[model samples]
Target: MSNEDVDSRRRRFLTITTGLGVVGTGFAVAPFALSMAPSERAKAIGAPVEVDISKIKPGAMRTEEWRGKPVWILNRTPDMLKTLPQMDKRLVDPKSEVDTQQPAYATNETRSIKPEILVLVGLCTHLNCSPLAKLKRGGSEGMEGDWLGGFFCPCHGSKFDLAGRVFKNVPAPTNMVVPPHTYLSDSRILIGVDKNKKSKKSKAKA
Candidate 1:
């Protein structure tokens, strides 16, 4: 054969070999690359969320998704605060003694760092269903007269007070979970993390 023809054949062989090597390397490394990358479930479970509460009006509620769960932020009014104590006798765990449900800083009557601002998991303790806001005094949509602005799960008639405390005789055994949270500022809060003065305890307990 001619030298030129031999050189052309050699070049073609090198090109084909290089392409096969690249393809083989990609197949060998693909599994490791996927393993190193975070799964969707892992990302959903540990992501932290920051929320702005500056524009949340009194008695209004805002919900944000974190770790694939709904975190509710309620701006309580004077009227809502007044009703909390009155419903204590009717609640199951009025004092919030269930230590597993909230951080130490949030183990208060309002289940929050600030009484005026409530942070709670929107899911009902009975079932994982999110509750509907019945934030109005008196009965609405089959709730009784004593319903003084809280959450109600229509799925099973489970009721939670303004502070997410379960009421007596309700299907829910405990109050709504108060997720680990800390105030970033007067008008902002971080969910899924407690970086406050008591963060160590909060992290341990939560």
Candidate 2:
């Protein structure tokens, strides 16, 4: 080939190769850039978690994650509710006196906003082990008799009553933590925030 023709072909090849390199780099970096960007779910880590409690059957429980921690929402039966007062004498903080463990709105006998719905962080206070739900009264769960439905930590033999009350003489120091929560509706609850803020917002709008 002539020199001029050869030079023109070389230029064309260089331009094509450069365009291919740019395209290849863009394809390689696209996934990396996406991985670095914060996802919608990640941004909601510290934000409120809303749950629908309507389908949660009585005496059953539902669990969700908030701030990378497991949070439980238990529907207490009338019988389960009665067991709280009975276990008070055996609980370390029966009345939830330790304010830091839960929000002030949940510092009641049931440790909940509603009388029947109990919300608590599922982690044990002693070592952060997740407790297993043992919701059977006087049933075969290692505890012989008078075993009101509650949670049992297999990790270190810690026990929590149905109301999340730490039994006396247990390894756990206090009751399970109650995350700040509020009832958006009869069957919907928002965790990680209290109802006071919602009420305040409503007042401001009025």
Candidate 3:
């Protein structure tokens, strides 16, 4: 064979070998890159969740999960809101005085950004037990006849009122936590983020 022919064959062999090596390196690195990406479970655990509130009718509630804990979104009816003040004298934190339990904007009578829509972490402050929604008044959920809409923790008999305020004698020490959240629109809310206090202040100033 001519020297030129031998050199041409050697060059062709080197090119093919280099291409194969490149393809193999890409295959090897692809899985590592994928593994480095966050998993679905990891995202679910810490990512912000957007909730659609349009389907939740007044006087009804919907639950969503964040960080492995249940979060409740309650659409309080006019009647339900009326019950909040009445339970104040009977509640441990009627005005949400415990600043740690909620953001500054939510430390109000309703314990929410909006008076009609309440968002709360469903776990009891005492034992982290999920509370049952006893949202009907007058003992409908097996409480006293004058029971206003609220939650009942069967685990330790802790009672929370319409605003997630703990009753005066309940096992839970503070009101249910109001997670940091903001309204994306009239019918959408994003949990795990604080509402824009600056905008609220500007509106108030206006």
TM-score versus the correct structure, for each prediction: 0.75, 0.75, 0.75
Q: Show model 1 residue runs off by greater than 4 Å.
A: 1-36, 196-206
lDDT of 2 by residue, 1-206 (tens): 89999999989966666555454221222333334547744554566777888989998888876777888999999998988888878888888887575677667899887889999899998999999999889968777488888998889988999988898888999898988888889988988888776688899999
- Residue range 77-154, candidate 1, lDDT tens digits: 999999988988889888788656467766678888899999988999998899999999987656787668899998
Query: In what order do the candidates fall by lDDT, top score first?
Result: 3, 2, 1
lDDT of 3: 0.81
Query: What value does the lDDT take at residue 127 in candidate 3?
Result: 95
Q: What is the C-alpha RMSD of each candidate to the true structure, in Å?
A: 13.4, 13.0, 14.4
Instruction: Score each candidate by Cα lDDT.
Output: 0.80, 0.81, 0.81
Give the local distance difference test score of model 1: 0.80
lDDT of 2 at 96: 87
Top-scoring candidate (lDDT): 3
> What is the per-residue lDDT of model 3 for residues 54-145, given as tens digits with 9 covering 90 to 100?
98899999887666578899999999999987887898877787656468867889988889999999999989999999999887678899
Give the lDDT of residue 85 in candidate 2: 84
